[model samples]
Target chain A: MADTMISEQVLAPIVENRAVAPDHVELIISSAVLSQAEPGQFAHILTPGMLRRPVSFSRIDQENGQVGLMFQIVGDGTRWLAERRHGEVLDILGPLGHGFAAPDPTKPWCLVGGGVGVPPLYAAAARYLHRSRPDVIIGARTADWVLMAQDFKDLGLDVTVATDDGTAGHAGTVMGPLETWLQDHPDGQVFACGPTPMLAAVSAACEGRATAYVALEQRMGCGIGACLACVVKAHGKEHAEYRRVCTEGPVFAAKELIW
Target chain B: MVIDVSVSLPRGLTLKNPVIAASGTFGFGPEYSRYVDIGALGGVSVKGVSPEPWLGNPTPRVWETPLGLLNSIGLQNPGMDVFLQEDLPFLRDQNAVVIVNIIGHTVDEYAQVAARMNHEPGVAALEVNISCPNIKEGGMSFGQDPDQAYAVMKAVRQVTDLPVMVKLSPNVTYPGLIAQAVEAAGADMISAINTLVGLAIDIKHRRPALGGVTGGLSGPAIKPVALRVVYEVAQSVNIPIIGMGGIATATDVLEFLLAGAQAVMVGTVTFQYPKRMNEIIEALPQVLHEYGFASVRDAVGQALPGRAPIRGGGQ
Candidate 1:
């Protein structure tokens, strides 16, 4: 109840809305209040439906007072969001949930992301650029489906891409490069955001050898932690307890997850 | 002119306004405090408290239907000990009227929670929840059976002197029969209706969308059914009725009042707009004036059968 981090609900005007990839739209909204958002935290966007869609902050520009949201058209909600035009206002509740913690300065770090999960890593990479460049690994179904590889590269971070069809830079899942990275930097920390299977793989690879922080996704309602709708199973005393993916995480240390 | 929205329920439980945040959705008062003024709300029916901390169901507990939401949260709470030690103190600090919604797997458990809340400071009333559809045992089972419902209410009534409002379920064949049974068992008031049991399939996975397989349906889609249940229960019981289910606007609140609900609980809509209850409370006076009703109490039972002719400017 006594929230140390303040989150705001605002009707932010859409400054820019365009397709960044196939069926993926990068929506930028003008909200000086939300520009203060941290990486891995999400914005609960009001769609043309009863429920709000929780989208991660793909890009945060504090100087311009804009927060960018990227999402694919998965259903009526995301499809409706993709159809929104520039200048239209979106009801957004945001900068919510605990974001990825800043990595240790002296230690080496790498980022791993998959599909839509790649966006928050881009925000993380943007923050990491302040200290030194961190390695980034992105995975997608094909070369065309790969998202934000160039975004990370433009940030001057060493980037590696993997696709299921062998059409992109290291074919197969992100595990190949992740395994190699873990072998080389045994003490390196990993920050990841992706599908559950890939995260479980990354968690397995980093176990006992390295540390990993993963950003998770789930179907959510009232992204402000009021509704206990979006919960993820985690190790708890006596038994596994359901933790709020919207609050206790969207970002959790990979070691803490049950999966 | 100012409209008197204050509602006086049985056992000295009086609300400054007619809008109470329903259980489960509001999350014990503090969750929405940043977006809403907790003290300004009529009352907050905290999520169902059992004797022990419940972990609830697995993932994918909620699904979005057209104009509605389906949830199978399974009443996850920190139990009576945590409620008194952690949650109730925060609400007390806010000076908010608290309505503890008690749930149990057995009649004894329900009475145990009721007994625990018996003289707890800052608690205005106890909302006995025997209508939740997510649990495997008790909950909706008690509400669906009149005799079982009567037994649960009677047990809680014996332990607590606070105004007890039994939340009714629409999934039953005759909600009024259950209402009358609880009334006879000494329930001071009734809140109709709890969410309707529903299902949504994830076509891609060819499995149920929610982890619970089925969940309680709530939102704008359930409003009409809730209104119907409120209208029916009003005639069956002499105690005041609190109508809730899909109330999103001041007009919706007034509709419940006309159908014999003394006050209304706002649930699913608050998930969409965190500050919605405050907005509805702010808009009620103008809406009441527009309808030629002097106050919230004046509009009660206006639409009930055999009542005097509708006397309102809008009509």
Candidate 2:
């Protein structure tokens, strides 16, 4: 099946570029594609290199036709993205993959994000604005690495920060505080995105208590389903079924993941 | 005056244009139709089909090289049953020729898939995938050995009435031998070369970049190698050839045609720009006009060294 909008690939101009974290830069691209993007959807950004780099959305503004991309300077691709000035056009094939299913409003929602993974959760948190504020837990290496804490607080969500080196809020991984938070709100659902290890721990913690949807990151080829480059194994009823993270989902139920 | 761009193979199959979407790059079908008119291209070679659904390689299946791409997709597909039931119906509606690229681990598996295709309505040809480098069995193994390639091609040729084209791998030392063997085994056409076996290391991680250890290399890096093989096989065989490797533009297509390929297949490039194949198809007429050829068919093997190479004539 065709997994993406064929005409959604756009050449959007960068309207804003600023450092949101020590190693991360936030890009505000003016594109109509933003209006169609849901929480956890990503864009295949063409850099000054061979393949397009997939980056998830950190924020979306429909009225202004702009979407935010927060990327760390991991390799040549992200470094190229960080260097671009305003008005430069970026070839983005996006708003792709099945995004997060909206959480039930009656039940409380808990959002867990680690390091660069914190961005996509912002958009997910925004969905809870008029209903009820969701509790957000963010993990980083240090105070300088922690991102968008104030932004989540601005949205009226309770923000808990965890740093490995203890330069900020809680002096450990976000899992510790997240576990305690889950205990207080037993009926809450959890949505998370972060390092594989962090996500795995969260998935393990939320096992039978609450349903969790985890956004995965993988090296991708065609941001569409045509290429099977971004496949991950499913642990559902079928023992060894492969699912494309770029097409079927970037966000999948934690129970479905084989990892 | 309108130029005749259509290409008719020595086999009964004929394509609307000389540009076909290579297998593995284009999905089952309908994946690219939303972006471009699928009927505009000469043909669409659907992804490699197997007897059963393949899960494919692990994560990190693709990596980007300079102007090339390395992938170990492992021929992930929905299998013959689902393909015949779900995928083929949509391809039947397209205006282009459909070349089903069939893959199997054994000779019997290959023949079974081919026999099943004989009942399918839309398929114009069967591209026997004996040269894929990603999968552990049956692909490159059959392609590298002339005897194995002959056996597989002969088996499928006997089971199906469709034109059988053996897709050869470049990993072997003597591709001409393999091509000759397949031709003798009733292969109506040849597609050379498949991706070259390659590996890329991540020095920091101290491991291979691809999860499958080594992958098949494609893109501009393999273009010259593909052209040389096509030139060599064109002179040594009686059947037509489909040349492909790192083909990106109309000039590349012209080069393949002049090097003795009757038609060309475009892959890897489709990933970087989804609609690029359409651009190349549209530009072919202008390109053929520049070279003083009235039709794309007229340009085939024009650059060969022989004053008069055999047309349908035997070598």
Candidate 3:
């Protein structure tokens, strides 16, 4: 937690840049500056362009001083980051924003991630050592889009996959299997990250029966809170107010979100 | 040797230095505290505030262009009531010069905001925002027309005792004429040039990239245009000029100052690095010294055509 102070850190030469799935790549860089990163915290990766691209930390390996960031090649900036070679240094501002809370060790934990959202959950699963293993549910558009299934399996946690086209695990949104899992483990708490609609569905699946947390995505200007570009409608104690996703949260409890 | 970098405007507004954080970039003041010291800046021109709370434009309000950025935030800001209650007090605590940027759809609306601000104790000055390119009827509409610009400045002047600096748009062909009008109408100082109107296409989607369709372009890309306006307007008006548009480094600051600006405002670069203004402020003394000047005033208008050479250096 102490190392979370914002600093311009260097990315150690890329030791690995492998394709994770279609249009997605997993980048591994060594950096001691990001050691305090807990689950759900993201880094603002600087590009040669004007705005810094915010990418969540998929894995924070404190022992080896390595941090893993997975991103899809959606735009020019991401494509630029994907083209970097070994030993090329990148500027990053992070260990930013509030991360997900540490769930109770005695109770079951359910982590629901959709598509690119699947990566951030891996770090949380590895960090949370508990009596019961966590249920990792991933949703993708098709069989070709499913990622990190083997990585979660290697961690020895219970893994579930749901593909929209019926080419993978549950043949629908991950909510179907997630709802079924909730019925059995009714005492579990859920944590989800994905597109807004998926998060809305996950929040609905909890339905006052369980507590849930969700991470939101917004177009950001200054990765710091100054620009007020990445604001979300959040319910405060008195009224609805704008909360910064970069500072207040990228991860917020489902009940507090206006959506 | 310590160099005195302070600057003084006509209305007794004295800044510790010449570098100011431009409006619409630095939020009321607390957001950038984590990275830089707010007190270190000469002044903070806050986001444009209207008479009422504005919800702003839809999603995808910002886009990146080569060496520049296009943003149509539509002057989104909490109204004056919230600003006075919440933002102003925080800025006062920082002890930096607080210049409030105000906008309106009509002349009365602009006057009402200034009148309200006139009663506020901590506000050091009023930057009449007649130049924002994003809004529909009031922004550039008031700026591009000299008659409307004079009327707006005159109305705002009648309401406020505090110093009023009219921020002008670069979109005008004869910004000099507009500067002269505002000066004659009762403007204490002038700030030029606001972002130039621009647009970008997604290409793949075959649609405009910005949600607002068009946005105000800023950054190093518009620095030349900013210099041109500052140079032209400075010769036309006697009031102090606060130059802005695409300013980033200490060298850029020096360029604006030499081009006949009393002070310079930094906008777009703040988005890239929140603490960049501090970096520019810190390096100014050395940069000024390298140009063989002891104070900021010594360099003002050094690049103007008719300026005489200094005793120690040839122009």
Candidate 4:
């Protein structure tokens, strides 16, 4: 049934834009439709002359019905998007892929993030904070690479920061802190979004002890399921038995995902 | 007051707008809804459905080549059974007309899928996909042989009285003949053209760019050829035509209309921008009005060059 009508004016302008880290920037948009989008969701914002690039919704302004898209200048699309002015219209198509999932409000949890993967965690942090502030751990190569430290702290949760360069809190990667926390806090569920290496490390560090969910990013087309361009492997299933990040999830339980 | 520039599609279906999401590009419809409401389009052509589930070709199914890309997805779809059980119910919930694209190896197989599809709850039309030759013994593509295409079309026509749109492949030598054959076999409309058969070899891998040795080239490159095919067929037939090929902008949509296509479908562009169909639809009226036409239908193939082309007011 084609012909579901909508008001024109999508791809609206972002009213505010600012840098959160040296390489990371945030664009606050007038996208009420996108803001209310679930925590595990992401957007595929159009870049100049390149394929639309998917970015995670870092945070939301529920009162103003706006969304915060956080990203680093990873490629041509992002670098160009970074050069855009505050009021310029961005041909955005989101919230595109799946987002993070929250656990039972009563259940304690561990929140972990790596690199550009930190944004969606903030959204999950916001959701979890209202319920029960989960213990958070962030892993980055150096203190300069860590993102949104204050935002998570402002959420009033117990936070653990680790950097490979040992410039900040701990003297090792967040995986080291995460390992210690899982041993000490065994009952807590884990919600993690980060680099695959970090996710793999955290998944291994907490294996068989507690249930964990990890967010995945894949090269996508259509940001819908049409292209069949994006897929990740699964355990105990045929190589044919794959799931779409756009449709099924960008987030999956640790066991359901193979990598 | 917006005058609802949509058409009834002449296939017993009403379009909220004139922009239909082309097949093999929009997936099963429910997936893109999170970003843009797909139900807002004129219609949705679900991914290519087959008699059996297909795993599709290997990775590197696509490669972005400038404004467009090359894809050899090979119609990856959960068999019609799975689609009916797993995908259809969700589609029905969207409250938009769902057009199931049927691909089969033989005439009987085409008829079988079309007949079975006709019984589905939300299915509004049957679009016979005969161009998907990348797979084995599937799709009505044998119909590219004129008589073969006619056999498949006639077989499906016998079983299902629902409106059937024959999607013609550009690879066929004489698309106009195939169009005429389908029309004679009782096709209500025609959608041309499917991607042009092509290949891009990766020098490093020492193999073809697409996992499948060849891919169907869609996007701006084939649009002119698509327009010509539509223009020729429009003058040659009495049935309405659905023109498509690398349609991304309003001007592209207008060109299809001026070439005598009653409607237009936007495909590959959805990958880059899923909501592009909406933009084209929103931009269409202005494109039409800009040329001083009161309605979009007036712009249909009206821009044909003065070659004293064939006439078909046989209605």
RMSD of each: 2.8, 2.1, 3.8, 5.4
Clashing pairs in 3: B219-B246
Ranking by TM-score: 1, 2, 3, 4
lDDT of 3 at A57: 85
Q: What is the C-alpha lDDT of each candidate?
A: 0.90, 0.87, 0.85, 0.76
Measured with C-alpha atoms, the lDDT of residue B218 in candidate 4 is 80
Residue A58: error of model 1 in Å?
1.0
lDDT of 3 by residue, B1-315 (tens): 577788888768889998999998888888777666889999999999889887666556778899998887788788989999999999999997999999998999899899999969889999999988888889889999999999999999899889889999999899999999999999989999899999989897699987788999988999999999999988888788999988989999999988889899998887667778999999999999988989888888899888642121101
Q: Which DockQ value does candidate 4 get?
A: 0.29
Order the candidate numbers by DockQ, best to worst. 1, 2, 3, 4
User: Which segments of model 1 are wrong by more than 4 Å?
Assistant: A1-3, B308-315
TM-score of each: 0.97, 0.96, 0.89, 0.77
**lDDT tens per residue, model 4, A1-259:** 0113121225767888888788788888887667667776777777654356777788866678788888888656777877777788877665655556557766668888877788888888886676777888887778887888888888887778888888988978777878888888776688888877778877777678878888887656666565786666566355536677765678888778765
How well does chain B match by TM-score in each candidate? 0.97, 0.97, 0.96, 0.93
Please estimate how well model 1 matches the true structure, expressed as its whole-model Cα lDDT.
0.90
Candidate 3 lDDT for residue A186: 79
Q: Candidate 2: where is the Cα deviation over 4 Å?
A: A1-7, B307-315
- Model 4 over residues B263-311: C-alpha lDDT tens digits? 7888887766666777887787777777777776667767777743223
TM-score of A-chain in each prediction? 0.97, 0.96, 0.95, 0.91
DockQ of 2: 0.70
